[model samples]
Target: MIRFAVVDDHMIVHDGLQAMASRADDLEFVGAAETPDDALALLEETRPDVLVLDLRLNGESSTELCATVRRRHPDVIVLVFSAYGNTELLTQAIRAGAAGYVLKDTNTGRMPEILRELVRAGSYFDPRIAGSLLLTSISNPSEPVSFSERELAIIRLIARGANNHDIGEALNVSPHTVKFHVSTMFKRHGVHRRAELVRLAMDLQLLD
Candidate 1:
């Protein structure tokens, strides 16, 4: 079973998610919490495979919580399930190590399937927020950036949702090489996260 935990301040959301997970034969509703501290404790106790987290937990920054969880328990994947559609917050969450970002307004019926895909694929993003991310990247009027053909190839792989390991295998390079290139790309684009890099590449039409 794909064991999961929920960290949302709303009891209603928690109950709804719990009920949804309980109905899915492949999913296990591990536990729920209303604050970052409580979520950390619950995660420590349950050691769930995935964490369904809210962007705001009792008015605290859930992005930081995601970073902390990732630092403390790298095995537990974090999926940001929030009502807010702020692209800045989404970017921060991605940078903080959330593997997925799904808006709560999305059909709750699809959450289990999304969570399953996230656990299987290692990354996911809500369609509703994707356009905004692209727009955000495009709106940033930085000096024009250029990339080499190989860098463009890697960016295309990233745009297609390939992780560093997958990119390394596809390019017949070591993961370290892929990391080096990605880091170089990040510095060139003045971005710090994979999601941002992909979005910027899309904005530049580099993936075309």
Candidate 2:
């Protein structure tokens, strides 16, 4: 089961999501919190696979919270569950290390599948907000983005047009692991496709 938690201030959202997860065989609603502090504590207690975070907690953006969760709990995928579709905010969330962003008004029924896709691919963006954010410039162009040695190896293989299976064979890791690394790179550069990722890596001279 995909263990998950929520960090929304609204009681209704908490109750609703708990109900939704209880119905899904593969999803476990591990816990919920109302603020960033409590969310941190809850994460320590539960160590869930995913975190369903609200973009705005008590009328303020939770970009900082997202970043903290990511830095502290790198294995836990943060999925922003927000009502607003502001492109700037979405871009900020992505840059803050949110692995998935889904609008509250969109179909909640697909959330299970979305969460699964996120765990498998390491990223997901709602179709509504994806196009504009894809075109938006990175929030901080001057910020240096570095990759681990393993990630660099995957990038070199991708640049050579190796598929995930080929890359897996070359690296002696599973194809799923290779795809996860590629998708994380896509999120890191704010790009959605492999070609975009490769081009950005080249522009950044990361492939050197």
Candidate 3:
């Protein structure tokens, strides 16, 4: 069984999800929490294979919470559930190391399959959100956003608003090389300016 811990404020959502997991032969509804603090405490005590996290829990900031969980328990995989499926929020969660995101309309029937895939393979994508992600990819096919591993590292630094000279010093490369990488990133991301590329990289979760 794929052990799971749920973090959601709504009792109904919690109960319903528990019931659904109980009905699945391969899923174990190990525990549930209504807040980030409680969830953290629970996770420290019992390490679940998957954390079914509600993106908006009462008034808590789920993005920071997700990042914190990842830092504290790097082994626990997080599957975020959101009511809005906001692109910014989804991207932010992914950048913080969430393994998946599912909108509230996600099909319950496929929940078991998704959990299985996550447990066995360490990944899962909610179909509805996958469609949105695919649309983004297709629409931006010519966006000039391809990044090599080295370029990706540079972009992450750029995302921190690092100056070319500072970035070069930190990365142990010449300033000219950093400038070239930045210029290439701008060209590939289809942006005319450095700030735009920074925003785009963050949006694409190419930089945290």
Question: lDDT of all the models against the reference?
Answer: 0.83, 0.84, 0.76
TM-score quality measure for candidate 3: 0.64
Q: In model 1, which runs have C-alpha deviations exceeding 4 angstroms? A: 138-208
User: Which tens-of-lDDT digit does each residue in 1-208 have in candidate 1?
Assistant: 9999999999999899889987899999989999888999999899999999988766456777899999999999999987655565677788899999998888879988898899889988987776767775888756234578888889888878899899999999998999999998765555678776665555344566
Candidates ranked, most accurate by TM-score first: 1, 2, 3
Question: What would the per-residue lDDT of candidate 3 be over residues 92-158, giving only the tens digit for each residue?
Answer: 6787789888777777777888778877888776665566656766887655434677777777776
RMSD of each: 15.5, 16.3, 10.7
lDDT per residue as tens, model 2, 1-208? 9999999999999998899898899999999999999999999999999999998788567889999999999999999997755555676788899999998887768888999999999998998778766555455555434668898888888889999999999999999999899888766555667765555445345676
The TM-scores, one per candidate, come to 0.66, 0.65, 0.64
Q: Record all residue pairs in model 1 with backbone atoms less than 3 Å apart, i.e. clashing.
A: none
Position 156, candidate 2: lDDT: 85
Which whole-number lDDT from 0 to 100 does residue 178 have in model 1? 94
Best by TM-score, which number?
A: 1
- Candidate 2 vs candidate 3: the lDDT winner is 2
Ranking by lDDT: 2, 1, 3
lDDT of 1 at 144: 36
